[model samples]
Target chain A: GESVGLHLPTLSVQEGDNSIINCAYSNSASDYFIWYKQESGKGPQFIIDIRSNMDKRQGQRVTVLLNKTVKHLSLQIAATQPGDSAVYFCAENKATDKLIFGTGTRLQVFP
Target chain B: SQTIHQWPATLVQPVGSPLSLECTVEGTSNPNLYWYRQAAGRGLQLLFYSIGIDQISSEVPQNLSASRPQDRQFILSSKKLLLSDSGFYLCAWSPILWGLRINTEAFFGHGTRLTVV
Candidate 1:
């Protein structure tokens, strides 16, 4: 079965440092990718999204990069903060309108 | 300005018990509704979606089913629940972006935590 996976189960970063989370997906037909932030015992929150037509998308303080050739997706946070600490998940939306999610990487920002 | 609501924030039910989780979307019309599940320390799994009223699509074959009785009301139900069905259920709605396909972002509710013993 086609699915998505993250490179790390957990990532620790300094409060003032930048953070990058990596994700790999096996579904080549996927055209849309999204990054979500989930806090403790809460539903996932939308962070940013990128389409196949473009390789990069930027939001307020977050950026999403897509490498179609490698089927890789990444989310970058500038000056990571304590509030940025959460479980990050990369989701791929196939042509069928179904989203398959990656395991997730827990981002821990040290104060 | 859209909001998604999922109710019975937490539940404790025994195996083989019937289950029903409600999700309602407000401030949006004809939005795409979705149901997702997340196990302990796992990722969000897509369970069902509805593009319109009375339209439902199931992604996995399981003891669960979905219904869209109204335009923005989606329901997840199970005739008999299993122990493995215990998890967090989330409902989301993707607003119409430019009146095109599903190219917009999704708004998620707080979520329903189910514990099936």
Candidate 2:
């Protein structure tokens, strides 16, 4: 069975510091990966995504890096702010097939 | 812009009670709909997905069932509820072009908090 998992269950970071969250997936056939942020009592919000073909993709203040060799995915948030505190999840799927989600990593920002 | 709507932000039900959660999408046609359940401090578990009206696929076998009555309407229902059914239920929608699914991210609703007591 294929599974997606996070390396850390909880992460604490000082405000203005860079935050990195790591995820490992077992499905090599999955070609699409996405990262989501979920606040308390809210639905998960899309943060960024990277295809298997690309090694890295950057958004406003976030970057997603994928390493197909190790089946690893990571999300980097620059100058992390207090509002960046939330649970982050990484999901993977084959094209448009069902997306498989990993246990979320809770990012806590301390001022 | 497309938006997903889910109702009953919070629900409290007893054992053996009937349950129904509704979700709908606006501003999109023939979108792919999905129902996901997240337990407290857990990841999202996909329960059901629909590619079109009356077309559905269930990922897990449980006491609950899902139906797409209309193009934009998706419903999760159960004739009798159990304690294990309590969780945060989320409805999501994604774009489907020419019968092919796209890479566009799925948009999730606010989610319904179900507490079966």
Candidate 3:
């Protein structure tokens, strides 16, 4: 079965540094992708999204990069803060209006 | 400015008990509703999605079921709960394009924590 997956289960970084989370998807038909930030005991919050047409989209301090050729997606966060520590997930939009999610990567920002 | 509301922030039920979790969307009409489950230290699993009233799709087979009674309300239910069903459940809504397609991104609610023992 086609699936979406992340490269790391946990990523540790220092405050004020840039953090990158990577994802790999197997479905070529997916046209849209999203990154979500989930805190403990809360729902996932929308961070950024990118369509297949464009390779990169930037928002605030977050950037989403999509490479259709390699079926890869990434989220880059600048100036990582303590509040930015959360589980990040990459989602692929399937044809049925469903968002297939990856296993998630726990981002730990330490001072 | 659409917001999603899911009830019962936390719940504890015994095995074989009935369950009902409700979600509603405000400030948006004809939005696509979805139910997703996330286990501890895991990613999200899509359980159900609804484009409109009575139009729901289940992604995987399980002891749970979902319904869209109204345009803005989505409900997840189970006749008998299983220990494996314990997890954090989230409700989300997305804009509908031309009443047939869904938008790129989805907004999510706070979520419900279910514990079945």
- Local error of candidate 3 at residue B108 (angstroms): 0.8
Question: Can you write out model 2's per-residue Cα lDDT over A31-61, one digit (the tens) per residue?
Answer: 8999999999999999999988899999989
For model 3, the docking class works out as medium
Each model's TM-score, in the order given? 0.94, 0.97, 0.97
Question: Which 10-residue span in candidate 2 chain B carries the lowest summed lDDT?
Answer: B96-105
lDDT of 2 by residue, B76-105 (tens): 999999999999999998888777786667
CAPRI band for model 2: medium
Give the per-residue Cα lDDT of candidate 1 at B99: 76
Regions of candidate 3 where Cα sits further than 4 Å from its true position: B98-102
Clashing residue pairs found in predicted model 1: none
Computed on alpha carbons, the lDDT of every model, listed in order, comes to: 0.91, 0.94, 0.93
- Candidate 1: segments with Cα more than 4 A from true spot: none
Task: Give the Cα error of residue A41 in candidate 2, in Å.
Answer: 0.1
| A1-111 per-residue lDDT for model 1 (tens digits) | 899999999999999999999999998888989899999999888898998999999998899999999999999999999999999999887756566789999999998
Q: List residue ranges in candidate 2 displaced over 4 A.
A: none
Q: After superposition, how far is residue B20 of candidate 3 from its true place, in Å?
A: 0.5
Candidate 1 structure quality by residue, lDDT tens digits, B21-94: 99999897988889999999988889998889988898889999999999989999999999999999999888
Superposition error at B13 for model 3 (Å)? 0.4
